[model samples]
Target: MSDATSPVPAAAPVARKVTSIGLGLLAVGGALSAWAFFDEDLRTRFGFGYMVGFTFAWAIVLGSLFFVALQHATASVWSVVLRRVAEMLASPMLILAVLYIPLLLVALLHPDSTIFPWRNPTSEMAEHAVHVKGSYLNETGFLVRTALFFSIWIFFTWFFVRGSLNQDGGRRADITERLRKFSGPFIILFAFTATFASFDWLMSLEPNWFSTIYGVYVFGGITLSALAAITLALSALKRSGLIAPELIRKDHLYSLGGLLFAFTCFWGYIAFSQYMLIWYANMPEETIYYTKRLSNGWAGVTVALAFVRFVIPFLFLLSRQVKTDERKLGMISIFILFGQLFDLYWLVMPNSFGEAGPGFGIPELGPVLFFCGVLLVAYGRFVRRHPVVAMGDPHFEASRGFRLH
Candidate 1:
């Protein structure tokens, strides 16, 4: 995909440099984790916290692939440039697969894991719930479903991105058509796989407590947070001279801002629905999930999640000017990113301690930064190796010229 007049050509050397730095961070992070593993208390808590933070960052990239797929399936015109941003964000899935090894070891090979309460054969929590759920929640099933989720996700993302890149050279309309056709079924498969993965990886933490709509709740945050992160990345690129500064027109930003706004509300609706039903039914099993989050210092985190993740984003993005301004949008994006981290922490950490809250410190901080490094490097490397713009899409020129009325 090399040409003299290409607007965003590949930068393989830079991608290699970024990938190397990412590897270095993983080394340091792993060493620190290994050192902490010698202490039993630190091992369980640190491992669990790291998984929470790593999954938090990893979800955004996976969510970006969903955006890209939906755009293709819908034949969205204005997102042609923006779609590239989503594509690059998805590169971290490759690394995330590598990261899952330790989690697998913890979940399947180890004697017990604090992160996955159901994995321990001897814990009272496991004894109470695992028997009932054992058929579905077995380690083999967990690993299999995880492998399937990533398989479906990674294959579709790779195919979709590779097709888009090929279009950069061939400019074949049929290529776009084939992609659009494939994207329809691919998205349905993605939804199914994501839902089951959520059930296995997250909801299983509590084991006994369950929600029918939990996957949808996770999906809402995934889409919204992914959009927010994309907005921030796009703004950074505009500022750094990576692409034409004027290329990120108000229309593009507006589309992103609109998704962010819509999903913020959607998240609130889903969360409220889940909480409402659980509260109304007052069943012991269903109530435990919310009860854990609402007690023992976690209450503060729950209220903060409502405001920071939903309320604040809702209020700010309500204004058309804020949605249209790159700086303002970027700020909101950063806030939403932090909200996602806090939100995941709220979801995963409390379960590890069992009716108590773990204080946040180096044990939590180190692994999170390490995983974030993996995500950052993967994204930076991806963008460097591909054109910033989907130059061959038929909608490319129209997207460039698009304006908000």
Candidate 2:
């Protein structure tokens, strides 16, 4: 097929302006995170730690979504039109991997008390459980696991991104085939790494608590959040006239919106299922996690998530018209994004502050801004190097013609 007929492009280079707004936000956010981290007050420090963690976690979500899109783009004929968008999203993974340095520092310097309770030798809180899981949750073990996780993420992201960029530079068909071959194994690696990463960072907050489904629940939440972020980014890019309107139609918007809705439901189901299982089993170790959340000010936050993340959006997005309308979809996207923040807050904050109460002080806001800034800096650089679309895919024709069934 000719360039016009094919969904993928040859060697078309697109110009993207250098916008430092995201970077500026990151700088201010980082300063706030640092101040919160060192503050003497536990409540204040916990709030900031939550913010910092959430900010970085959101960046990971975005990057992972990008990777998921690329998987579809390279493998599925249905995704040719949306492939470029996925590529744009995946481009930031490299930076997300690099930004792990600070988190590593946090995990290393304060292994005993910051997030992992088992790190402390004197804590009676998980004394029995800690003794059991000490082999895996210890400072030395955690460092090894974390290093392995980042190493895998960094390798896959670089390999996938570099391969796509090479295609843009007019590499031979063999290179394209090589990328397709690599994607399958890369995805498998991602699945394992993401699961382990979630367990270490979030689930381990209550080391005694264990759930096989926690990783899946987190994956669902991150996927939904990432889709919302992609929609917002695509809308913003289109507004700037960077992407061709012909390439992005109501059909595309509908597909994305539908996926968002589906995942929202999936996240809720997984969350409730985990709770139900724990509640039914009534194991003291597992029940304590929810018990803490239910008693403290955290109960109110949980109610908010039930309404904002699931119920409200679930009802609002039920309409066919809402999914296809760009303006409406964009607004809903904003809602989902905020809901995601709340969802993470609910998950991490309680572990840090218990049921004392929920608050969004500098400790919370600063890290969020800092990580957001890091994301912008990375995304900005990616855009500057490549076209917003995948011009070389053989299935571009089918992608442009994609429609809702």
Candidate 3:
């Protein structure tokens, strides 16, 4: 049981620091991203870069939402203390909904732009697979589907965050039961929405290339990246003395590390499975996706992604000592986040560059920094406004005693 009682401590001081940094990054990243759009000719290149930044950030946010849902559905006790942080991490889904508008405008206004070939299919593209997929890939369908995806996300986020907040500081535990009951259904909704969203946003980038498991592939990254992000946040709170050592124990930290290790493996497994299936089939349409990524300048990025995202973390996190050590685990969490960005960059950039190879510069950095700012500000604001721990949860006391056997 928890040694601490009743009213949970507030996180205002930490919130201020996080929000300040977030605002600064938001300004700079917003300015640079805006500058990239001025030159119409460069719009296609930078627009695609913007997609990379957006996806990199959104994956983490959406993944955090999944984490919250999973906790409630499984009634997991160990994560009760940490669930508030995950809830805060996920609160940014609304922000992403707004950020998505500009991209949608681009989709609506510049369909002919190289970013989406279906908008203005070329002579060769006209005869290819783009033709058959026209009904599903049209601009209107894209817009409607985007709306559906965001609606599902917003409703669930509100339900969980609001419900949890309402239950703060020894309130009725019935709300907990209510949340738990609905969590299973929320996850079912998450799977369908996340899968289709991946299909619409990322997979559609390469209309000709299709993967039945693409959504699963992105899900692996999303959950893995979300866990890494959560680990980083908890580590920061611990180091800053915002989260008392007693509230978040070494067992909790170890659990976080073990999750990171497991998901890294999961992501790697999905990645290899997708590639292996495609390779074995030797189908031109599917193979083209790997071909672009595997050859020339892009090849190095693929190799680097696998090593940094999987192999390095897999080996480093194996030791029990490393999982419990804040500094050591924090360092890898940072890298895992970077790997998530690089993985998205790898997925989105190659299509824009084609045989010219990978391109990275101001255009790429702008959107990334912009989304980073948005996330920081959102999370900070959430922490500032509410309790950092789920003190109202019936399971909160048991979570304090959570330990590995």
Best by lDDT: 3
Q: Estimate the overall C-alpha local distance difference test score of candidate 1.
A: 0.79
**Clashes per candidate, residues 3 or more apart or on different chains:** 0, 12, 0
Per-candidate TM-score against the hidden true structure: 0.92, 0.88, 0.95
Checking candidate 1 for backbone clashes, the offending pairs are none
Which scores greater on TM-score, model 1 or model 2? 1
How are the candidates ranked when ordered by lDDT, highest leading?
3, 1, 2
Residues 18-76, model 3: lDDT tens digits: 98999999999999888887777667777887888888888888898899999999999
Better of 1 and 2 by lDDT: 1
- Candidate 3's C-alpha runs over 4 A off are 1-10
Candidate 1 least-lDDT 10 residues = 1-10
- Model 2, 144: alpha-carbon shift in Å? 1.6
Q: Is candidate 2 or 3 superior in TM-score?
A: 3
Span of 10 residues, lowest total lDDT, candidate 2: 7-16
TM-score of 2: 0.88
